[model samples]
Target chain A: MQRRLFLQGMLGVVAATRLPASTLLPLMLNGCQREPLLPGTLLSACDDARGNHFVASIQPDGSLGFQIPVPLRAHDSCASKQRDRALFFARRPGRQIYVVDLHERLLIQTIDAEPGRHFYGHGVISADGQWLFTTEQIYATGQGMIGVYRMSQPIRRETEFSSHGMDPHQLQWLSDGETLVIANGGILTHPDQNRENLNPDTMQPALTYVRVRDGALLESHQPPHHQMSLHHLDVSAQDQVVVGVQHQGALTDAVALVGSHRRGSDMQWWMADELTQLRMQQYTASVAVDANGGQAVVSCPRGNGIAVWDMQTGQLINMLDIADAAGVRRQPQQSGWVGTNGAGALVRIDSSGTATALQTLRQYPLRWDNHATLI
Target chain B: MKPRFVRKSRYEKKNRYVRKKMQLLLLIVALLSLAACNDDMTPGQRWLATTTEQIRQGYQQLSAQTRAQQQMADAFCQQPDAQGLQTMQAAWRESMASWQHMQWLRMGPIAQDNDDWKLQFWPDKKNILQRKMQDILEGSEPVSADSLVHASVVVQGFSAQELLLFDPQFATVEKFAGRQCDLLRASTTLTARVGQKLADAWQDETWLKRWVAPTATQAGLTPAHVRNGEILDALLAQIERIKNDKLGEPMGLKTRDKKPNGYFAESWRSENSLANLQNNLLAVQQLIRPAQGYGLFQYLKDSQQQALADEMVIKLDNAQQALQQIHPPLTSAVTDAAQQPALQNAHRALGELATFCKQKLAPALGLTLGFNSNDGD
Candidate 1:
């Protein structure tokens, strides 16, 4: 009888707060029986108008579920399949990582980067969900290191390995789950020198596949252009990798910004028409592939648009206009994609190339960051 | 086989109705309380509304001054007398001062459409303005509204007008003979038109409302506090620019030769650099603590940041006082070794204000510099 009264009191509080019925339903159930909360469809980092950073959970329909503030600016987040938790990594040259328990809707722990090391804003959890791999930079020598962590109660850094290139950015697991494909964005930078690209003229970016168990380089592939700094990537269930590159060359030079790569094979460059290329402004912020592995979308924040490509033919399919659009992720149950922008717009693009604004989600004036991930 | 039926008591029915009435009353009270909470304005929101009004007034003042400048220029061209020229110069100075008041708030429409640079292009290390103006004078380019619209921005604004009216080579009546007079008239006309457009743009009620209460669908999510930070940044940037680039460069602090460079000072030919800096300080003062109204200082105090508010006001006063000690014709003063002490004091005071804003107030306000504007690559 006491427990029932306590549950009633909690329900009254939730009702007074005017929380959404869906959110209240979970709370009510958990009050009666302690059950783990279900994961949401989308997650992204955001900065409120006052410059406070937060990890926001978004519903499948793009409504906001909840937000947990972080002390520093967060770049990207990866959800864990083995545990009801997610990891938020700080941007490059930043030394903080936040571990959030999704079920509890709370930050569990904060892990500081080792001295003389910083994260590059991308990571992947193993298929078994026991290991978390993060791309880091050895600031002293400008080398890339893949830091491996054991996902125990207290996350522990088990070991690390050289990423076989400089400035390794985003990485993902292969179908076999043992091989990790990494995008070594060849731009070299040091925290002391600010964000100056020290090796612009000598950059040689490449895609390298490495063995996670032994840290051995299994295969490496380079694009035709030497100045294309491969930055972000997304892998399909079929093991197809779509890479997005930010050009470090002259602005006048029009180069391919998207490429497709497979293990033991050369990368194929995908180019839009000349006018479309000019519209892209030579920068691709994020990339995501549909569940079917047939269509890939790349966000161009500078251009304020997103370009969809036919993965099979390497041809431009469609381009959707979105102001300051950056973050994008494929929907879990559908063939469509959802994108967010610095303008605080949330849009879902259907397979038929129709874009619909998620009005309820866009009601809050929060600027979403460069990347959003699916949970 | 007939069944007997029981009827409910009238008191029981009445009690049910009473309970229902009580529940409805509770819901209505809850809704009214929620509405009251929603209607109350946050301190940040109030600050935004006040700042918007300040900006509108500033731009309206600019429009009026520029219109007067155009008329004075026309009068001088028609008479070509000494008195007429002097009146025109005074009018031009007033107009430029007004522009300086709005220069620090460099975003929004002013930042777009290349209007920011068109108003004033600074740090001309290569004297591109002179070269561009000379090319226009030597060529057969028609000096009209249409042609000037396509002309280089450096030749169509206040700096170009200053060159023609103050520089020794072009100050005489003979220099205003044919095409030069047309150019001067066209430049002043364009300047007035630009000013009026800026004023009209700021007068939009819809834009002001959205700016004060922005939603996510807006092109740039400008929340009230973010707007507060923007104003703070602009205030700090203006003071810093005055201390570092405007004064420091001419004072030899930023130069390799370690000697004063008179040519580096803004409005050097007109000898109004000190006057411009004084007007900039006045503008800063108006933003901090405007007379007859509340300003950012009041907002900060209301937010429980009285210490920071007091520091800003005190430092602003100190900088203004220091600036008063420095005489006009800042170019000559920087070059004169005897006036070095006064110049150094002014620089130090202004530098203190800039440092306080950047180090103390920005953090207190929860603002970060160059995070959004700078390229993140």
Candidate 2:
């Protein structure tokens, strides 16, 4: 092979059309900064807007590899528990899914998707690695749907069930066994963007459960707060669900709610939406259940702390301040989630909420790299 | 008498007045011509002075350029990025220690020719791996947020772009070819480091054994596992003697002028065919190979087993051919030509493999033993 070809294959190549010198200088300087690590290095991670191209990995000795760069625009990512792979989904305007081989570090394969008539949210892969499900925030032709992909084959099966309302932000299987209960945090959007002219009187944000074997959209329950953008979610071992809300403008609390399915309808709301939103700012990227799921963690990027929630009781257990933290990760072994505090050093958040010091990577402050590894 | 005198005086006076007016006109024409010539001379003098100044400025610019080039040369000799390549080369040796633990790179269950026959497999494996081991055989693809990308992005804004675009050379370096040049610069450093190693290896013939370490590890055997360490050590000694006698020894660089033979030149560019092939193999090998999960020997089907045996025989023949090709006078020349292509390829391919294994492959394997993930980025 020629040197150019070898280089093209070895590193990465982009179009080389010349730009003005002013445009190129900063990129040269930016190349000096190393990438940041995402949180939950082992359990797997996923986030909103199909930012799935973001992938992070870490060694047992604390060596961090952050944000697997993608050719296309990625909105969210989901790490798989059964394999050393990250599934990334592109955002609206495109439907290309990139699969990063955590072992190889290169982009192993890509699943071409057509977001032809819908917008997408964060997605998740099954523990068995058989199924991959994601929420279609807006379905132009049909009611809001959850698209299901069979990993072994190229075919896709969409569950055309009304999300009880509009946009479903995050999707996950609630329990391990036969029933497939998904936390469908609901809001409605235009088929292309998030500009949903929701009727304040009729609009409701819901959590819906589905039975996978039968493809039944069994039950739907709305959250008490209509304005909360309940987009991120994680399920615990005992079937408790931990959810984080990205409050829309004017809403006070960016809440974390814990509850389980009761009978058919969503019941026993021990943790209702807390009025925690200060100045209506914090954008919650992710929420995760620990290895045991006894405790849950939330990423408050604006506050620079991973707010811990007690699973048994619906209460804010503690807020691990990451103001000095650069890239804060929970579940460092499974989901290597990372955050930036406008600084260089990465603050590592282990699965147990123990924060530790990370190395100074680059000048650029870290951002959430969609999903982290589930080693 | 009075009439005659008046007529003569009047005639003489009229003649004198006509002569004086003609002389005054002549004087005015002369002054006009002189003024015209002086105006033309002003332009001529200005042109001559401007040309001289330009030439002087050009000479000074050329001098400055030469001085800058010299400074660049000096800095390039000791720059961190330059020395970094050498550090990477040395780091390669340490990386080999980890490869020794890998079972696949060890000696095959069936051994023939040399006891350390496993060492020869890397040359063969390089042929087989294609595209699959990219992560293992190559470093992580450059990330988007890298300095190269950011520098380019920064130029898109107004002020810097306008200023840089005005200067063609600086603009090209900044916008058009900055990132690529940076990468190439890094690669050149890496090449020099590897070249240094090759130079030392030429001095010591036992260098081939070290190069074969990865190949040996691929075969599932090691120096400790081999039956007699003493016999292998003696063979290494013999190899070393042949290498030393044939290649001579490195006497620093001071006595280079007196040496009869010169094995190295300033720069040599190859098709990189060998390096490319090795990279291909490493990429495939580094992937989640089905054979790797179990031992390569154990997973070998009946047909694969026969193929392995046949390949081993071919390798032995090649080794024999290599040994026979060695002659006292022609050894260095032949070795230079034969080894240059393969060594360059091997070193580069190994560098890629080491990086991939460390970055992506190991993490995928879930071997991260309490190491913090955030620090690596």
Candidate 3:
């Protein structure tokens, strides 16, 4: 019930009630101004009409909250355990991570990658919020590294561990919290090459599970096809992982691009109807499991559709036509999902296969980026 | 040397000249600003609006032809004669021709609910259609249009009807004793119903609004830019399919070490594979330079790339002409060595056209095709 309340609160909380900047000046001087938990329901890296990059926040009601400008475009973001702040990481080849203090509605810190490392544009905070783990790669060798940071006074980088694969992109927390499940995309790319896949023919992608406390490799499994690069995923309360694949081969290669794996089991791929497969187009942007873990939703931005699957049976339940679908996440107060598209529309997705525009989403001249995070 | 009165007049004349110049400058600025904020459709936008209308009309034709086909099938089933069989096949071909003309390059109401596939399912490499159709014919229950609503896509639409009408084993009126007529009437009825649904779907104004204006301005995105790129992408993509799947695959150019396999060809049972390929290219030609209104051809001309537009249309013309030069019954044509060069020329023309679209047309329009839609994470 409390979690539901938290989700509902994210949708709207009267942004007009925010204290004026003048009233908070004295508190800032004292260096002790802590406000509410992250002030918005949805957080994403967006670009404005003028092409300026920003780490933006929007309420459940689709009202704009904060737009913290950043130097480079960022990717997926994860809220801190305390919910007081959130971190947005720059995409590969970028070494900066922007930290936004939700209460102050300001970008409080910019964390730089260790001298020789760069981020893969994804990260997750521990359940207790003690540590922040990020996907990164050693620049010179193209080796994947998991950069661990102790969430201390200055948020310093403590150490790192090998990702056990190449081009690790997005990671999620298992039910145990300390166990991180990562999608090792396995495509070798150099930062200087401008996002080129240097080893497509030889790439080996995998879904891997690693222990954060000791950096131990618990389990690892490669995709059925060597060219099936696993990129983004989300884990449920049952530790069931749903991952989205980006195939680096012919478009007509009819391989399943979304699948699930529970530890110690073979991966179960979700197959859509043949027509739906045509719409999926072999690329997926995000994978989100609903609050109940009974359903999995994947946004196929390339195909401009969203597909939902029955978690237990791994069968497709519904396909929603959403043009340029960017990200999907479960609603704060219910079983359905909220999806954002590239056309600047927010759509509410019901498990019954009906997709409707979120009527209250205030129109903005902004394109929602590839991923969305909840505060 | 002039008098004081003459000097004053000269100064007045200079003042008048300066005022006139300033007014002309102001007028030019006002006109430029209007151009910047012009609500008038760009050449690309005009093409999209025109194409949308064209798509609606095409769907209407499909609905009408399919309805006529359903009626013709019922008439033939009641009479069961050779003449009736010929008439029924002609109606089926016309309906299929209408469908081939649609060539939806992207999403719309027809694409939203799997409606398009319910109307026609093709490229059956595994012969799922025949297997399912035979199973249905061998079943206990009497097949009807309502029953097919929930049936597998394999036994539905034009492909199933083709098996019933054209395949030698199923084509005879004597086969009606085994419920062949029932399957034909049911499949044709279902086809007509789905076609009508597609036509109805295209009438929604809300859908049209979303289809045309697709992206946010943060990327300098506009309706014309998005729709025009998709049209070009779809045209190029379908032509590639025709060159490869429809023509090359059956020719064994990409499979079985160059041994021609006629069974792989679409509409092989009906022996209309070559005709289908021609219709597909005709649809591509219509989109590139429609008979009426501003098409992609006009858009190209506005961008000062008329030569590129002409090259694409010319290439498509060459492809269709080459395809037409081949013999009937694509199933046998693939095995006839004499027809191989024509097939190869047609295939080469299609490949070159697709390359021109991707390389030349895209840049000339100041658009990058499939940036967000096809970009992988």
Candidate 4:
């Protein structure tokens, strides 16, 4: 009964958020039953306008299911198929992962950085959901390390691998599940300085493919420009990887901030027209590939727009405008992707250049973080 | 058929009626609360609305100046006298001042279609304007509004006109003989059209509404705090460009050997670089503390940071005075050691203003620098 009452209070907050399904959600996800809450279509780490952080679940029908307050702001999240669990990793320089028990609809456990190690705020679960690989760096040395953990022993870091470069972030597994592709942002940072690029001129950002078993660097490729920080990436079923770049140099630099890569070939640079490039402002927040593997969506938050690419042709197919646009993920039931912005907007961006407003919680005013997890 | 079922059905109908009444009451209460929320605008909200209006006014000034600029160009083309050239130059200066003031707006319609570049192309390190102008002049193709519609942006804007009207090689009465006149008319016509379109985009009060209470579709009305963060970024970026690109690079501050390059200075041919810089500063000053509006100054005062706001004013004034004191063209000043101190002082003043805005004013207003746009992975 106490748990039910707690859930009822949570439902109240979610309803007050007034997501797209504002009218029906208060009654739909009332959280009064003893049964575990069903998984939602999307899971994200969100922040409200008043500076409150939450691990939020967006229901399949496009309504707010639940939002649990967290002490720290999380970056990216991943769900485990082995059990009803989802882990939200704290952003860079952060040390903990909030483990949410889907069945109990509660934070089940917290994973801390082992001593001097801090997470880069992104990780990928194994295909069977048994093993977890997280991007980490030695806080003092600024060396990239991929921390591995077994789902059964969730709280402990079992092993580590060299990420082949510094500032490893946003890794994804290939279809074989034994290979991990890491976007080594190539900039060194200390927790004390707080995200300042300590080695801007010398940083060597790369796309590194590693053998998960032995932590061997299988292959690595660098961006055309050394200052381009390859930060976030998404892997398709066909082993195609799409990476987003954040240039540490001038915003007007003509560097392509989006690239696609195959294992044995050179990276393919994708760019928009000159005007589009100027609006993109040389920065991209997140990159997401659709389920079918023929299209990719990259969120250009600085540009206040999102660009969809035809993966087959390496061409920009559509550019949809959204204010502070970020955290785009493939639509579960369609080829389009859902995006969120800082102004509490959930937008549906289709490949055909159609953008549909799915939900807006402007008054409750949540700024969804850069990346969203399709649960 | 059962007696209990017949009684339950009647009870259900009565319950339904009561539920409908409750919903109606709830909706009315909800709407009243929303109305109450909208009654008094927060200081930040008021500032945004005022800023929106200021933006519209700024664009209007730009359009008017460009239209006048086109007229002057046409007048010069018809007569081609020294006095006519001077008048046309004055009009171009007026248009540039207004354009510089509004150049910091890198969003909405101006940036959406890159009309800003169409109005003025800067940092032309490769001398594309001179090359393109010579090419067009040498070519037999007719220059007109329709012909120049799809012309290279380098030749379609202020930079090309500046070169043609100011450079000694091109700015002569003899140079305005035929083709150059056609080029000037064509370019100014294009610029006026672009400026008018921008002004028209913001002519209505709907932009203000969209800016503050925007629907998710049209990309306006970001939370005031977040929008302020970007605005602050735009201000700082403009300052950086002015300090770094406009002055620092030409002054040899950015070079390894510290050798001044007069040719690199923008508007060096006409020696109007300092004048342009001054106009940009004046525009920034107006944006911060308009004569009558709830801008950054009033917003700061509302937030009880009057002292900080006053300091910003003092810094801006100091920079403006220092720059004005440099009597020579920025090209000469960049190379003259005698003018170095004044340039350094003005640069320092700009740095202080930017620092104060980013550190003191931003925090005072609850805006954080290097948020998502800067720090996002």
**Residue A277 lDDT, candidate 1, scale 0-100:** 69
**Winner by DockQ:** 3
Q: Which tens-of-lDDT digit does each residue in A86-120 have in candidate 4?
A: 89999998998989876557887899989998998
Per-candidate TM equals 0.63, 0.38, 0.68, 0.75
Which of candidates 1 and 3 is the stronger one according to lDDT?
3
DockQ of each: 0.07, 0.01, 0.13, 0.10
Interface RMSD of each: 7.3, 24.8, 6.3, 5.5
Q: Give the TM-score of candidate 1.
A: 0.63
| Model 3 lDDT tens row, A226-265 | 9999999988878899999988765546688888999999
Worst 10 residues of 4 chain A by lDDT: A7-16
Q: Which should have the higher TM-score, number 1 or number 2?
A: 1
Error of 4 at B12 (Å): 70
Put down candidate 3 lDDT per residue, B89-146, tens digits, no spaces.
Answer: 8998899899888854456776677666677776666777777888988899878889
Q: Write the per-residue lDDT of candidate 2 for residues A1-375, one digit (tens) a residue.
A: 653343222212222333356544544454443331222233122211222224444433233454465655455566655344667666543456777655455577777544554435356666787777766644454345666777653435444444444566666666655445454444444534434434434446667767666667667776666655566666666676666655443322334333434435454333332222331133555567666766666655443345666666655665554422222334433433343332222334433444432222222212334333334
Instruction: Superpose all Cα atoms of candidate 3 onto the true structure and report the RMSD in Å to 1 decimal.
Output: 14.9
- Give each model's whole-structure lDDT: 0.75, 0.38, 0.76, 0.76
Worst 10 residues of 1 chain B by lDDT: B368-377
Error of 2 at A76 (Å): 3.5
Candidate 1 regions exceeding 4 Å error are A1-73, A81-83, A106-115, A124-135, A144-374, B1-49, B72-92, B107-114, B122-143, B151-156, B159-184, B211-213, B216-278, B300-308, B319-371, B374-377
- At residue A255, what lDDT does model 4 achieve? 85
User: Best to worst by DockQ, what's the order?
Assistant: 3, 4, 1, 2
Give a tens-digit lDDT track for model 4, residues B1-377: 57764556778888985786455434433333342366565666666655766777798899999999998898789879999999888888888888888877777777667787777766665676788789999999999988987876778988888988898899999989999999999999999999899988875444443444444321233355555655665776677677777888788776446798877777777788888788788878877888876778887888888898898889889878887877678887877888889888877777787677666766566653433553466
Question: Total backbone clashes of model 4?
Answer: 0
